[model samples]
Target: MNAARTQTDRTTARSPRPRAVLAALAAAQFTVMLATSIVNVALPQIRDGVGLSDGATTWVVNAYGLAFGALLLAGGRVGDLLGRRRVLVAGLALFALASLAAGAATSPAALIAARALQGLGAAAIAPAALALVMESFPAGPARGRALGVWGAVSGAGGAGGVLLGGALTEAWGWPWIFHSVALATAGVLVAVVVCVPRPPGGRDEGPAGRFDLLGTTTVTLALTGLVWGLTTARGAGWTDPRVLGALGASVLLLLAFVVIERRRPDALIPPRLFRTGRVAAGNVLMALLGSVWIALFFFLPLYQQQVLGSGPLATGAGQLPFAAANMLGSSLAPLVARRIGARATVTGALLTEAAGLLWLSRMSADGSYLVDVLGPSVLVGLGLSVAFVQLTAFAVDGVPGKDTGLAGGLVNTTRQVGGAIGLAALTTLAGSVTAASAHEPLREALTAGYRSAFSASAAVLAAAALLALFLTRAGAPPAVPPAAPAPRPLTPEPSRAP
Candidate 1:
């Protein structure tokens, strides 16, 4: 009896603290997301430093996203098989080395190669880190709080990238931007190793599933082609031969991938995942949210620079309001969800986002940033942050620990793919509008194009709102410690009040 009591007490004492683990995981997430946008502001300096041709300059940015999006599923499967912590640490090491290489690159090709490597490392880090969060926090308020921090970091990371990159490039140099990332990554790695605990099972122990080579190759290549084609189409026309060819290849390859996965005993991403209504719906909503978020960032900058005549510094500063609001929303998401339920929260958020986009669509060439842009920016920021927090939590809820990494990968892939495709479509539409209005003054023409794009984005958000009403209704009973009640079903019966 004494020995049993002592053992129980020791086990209780050894239980991990949630705060340290959440901080480390949030930091890891922030580091990888920061990589995505940090290069944008430094592109000109990078081009000049490396003597990159006009066309080659784009590759420096595109290479990372291509590799990240293509290999995310495979990375997640590796984590599920090998171990999440092991994969995360390995990814951080690889990311650090790649960042160092990128910082030291003397040529465009070298920089692009390093960036791609960084993407591959990020693919590993992102899913594993998310899985760690899922495993560490139980399915209740603790988990909700952790996810809110993660979502806040994700939103702020993107916004901060522009600010950090510009400051680094202007003050120190272009290479320092990468070097700074390398140092931050190194610090996060140390923190993760020290602070984040192993999953409920011991570290480095997971089902040693057989690797699926054919499935991996087909899906990775298919996604690569899709993202590349969409990204290129934004610059080159959709009718461009390369764009059309890549899209064609993506479709055929995706079909082949589906066939391979159906037959394979160990698929990279099991088709069964999509069969779950909650998982499927969460992914769909995330994709829509991602599309609108990316489009907002892409076009708002153009509006600031072209229509408002803001300098780069001022334009970057103009984004601060959105970032601040997003962080506030992330913090508030869990509290609001607990009060109202996830279904209502998501529906309300989508509607709010649609309203914001509609307001933004009313911008004119003569509009002032403070007077016209601030309100909509804050609304959209809050909406995006709240939606991200709820969707991310819901997507992985009730997923077995073994497949947590896979769930993470699927949500991320959907977001990336959706953003790429939606941005391409919206950009094309905006370009056409601009060309048609060429007879108008330049500022007016540009404003006209931006307005049309924002209007389309609003429609997309509204459509997503309708889908959310149906799809996000499923709810798991909250695990202990007194959090929210079971979320209302997305498609509740008429008798049950949503």
Candidate 2:
């Protein structure tokens, strides 16, 4: 009770310019999300230009995702201890510097290293920005609207990454993609400095607490090992010694993390968080949802380019329909949530996703874009967009303000981990099908593999829908308005820089 009061005390002075704060937060989100997919279209050029073998090339993407997912929980904890705005600025600085390094890299090793640094920065920025948004807008109509815009930017940034990457790579070169990201991030950084107001203690004051070192180390390594093993399993085979060892070690480390968290005074993820049915169920469904969305982006490009013989630029442009639908859905999510409630909205969206994936599975070796792809892509995009917004609000709802950052980190980490695992599983399934169909024509074999993967993804979504129906709780707590202000101790003005 005292802790809750202390948290309420901390956020008493609401930022007067909520719109500016929302815009800055959304732009910050877009900047990090763009990095997630900007390099995807440029992967081929990166591999060739950096003299990387096919095997090593995957790391260019995997390294960033792995590091980002692994460190997210720790990053959120850090933000909770430090101020969210301060952590956000620090994260932006790191991300921009890493982008510079990535743009300048001439070797594969340097590129991969720089990508990992970018992931670390992203791990910090994503959760802090989210927490800041939640704090800035008092929960009610204002908060719902802010979250709607926030979700739209998150979805659009990811979908737009493909289009932007293609244009930049085709016009200039692969390095230019990173350079562009660096510039955009710098712009957002400046907006953040000017637009985001400091909290009552002038941003320097934070909740006095000890960092949970033991819990942090254990959870970070456990997630890293798990993500590494799953990502490598597609190429290495599940039975390979290295893959088996990593999986086994991850399991042991996770147990250790659980044990450590139970005993630690300042747990990285408090054990009681799981007791909240909403948080637990939200995280689980988010994982399944993440897997499907990530795999869709991954496999759809393959189908477009390899099967349809489209160029990279055309393939990226093809996703514009999905992006459009996603933005439309995001804009409508708050209304839907208000009408039917968050849980039902999410359940309905998941079912819609299943239906869309099932439609997509109807594709043949020679499929028409309009009938076979576009219609289903639009459905999937809209459904996933609504799901993303509702699920995000549901996950952190009812949690104390102090722990909202951790909740955000937890949900995002699960999503990333789920994506990695799902992609690997589906990739292996497709590889096996392709090998088995080796007797058929190459195009037919590839189509069969992709079709099977899409079917599997649809099944996953249906299962997730069922889980949402049964496990997810209905309605969130009413948003607590900020407390009235009292005179705060004098401190130095917040630094615009770290």
CA RMSD of all predictions: 5.6, 5.3
Ten residues in sequence with the least summed lDDT for candidate 1: 489-498
Cα lDDT tens digits for candidate 2, 303-412: 88788877778878988999898888888888887777677788899999889999888898888677778999999989999888877776676667777778879988
lDDT of each: 0.83, 0.83
Off by over 4 Å in 1: 1-16, 199-203, 271-277, 474-498
Candidate 2: Cα lDDT at 498: 5
Q: Kindly report which residue pairs in candidate 2 clash with one another.
A: none
- Sequence-dependent TM-score of model 1: 0.91
Error of 2 at 281 (Å): 1.2
TM-score of every model versus the real structure: 0.91, 0.92
Tens digits of per-residue lDDT for model 1, 343-420: 888888888889999999999899889876889999998988888998887677666667788889888888878888
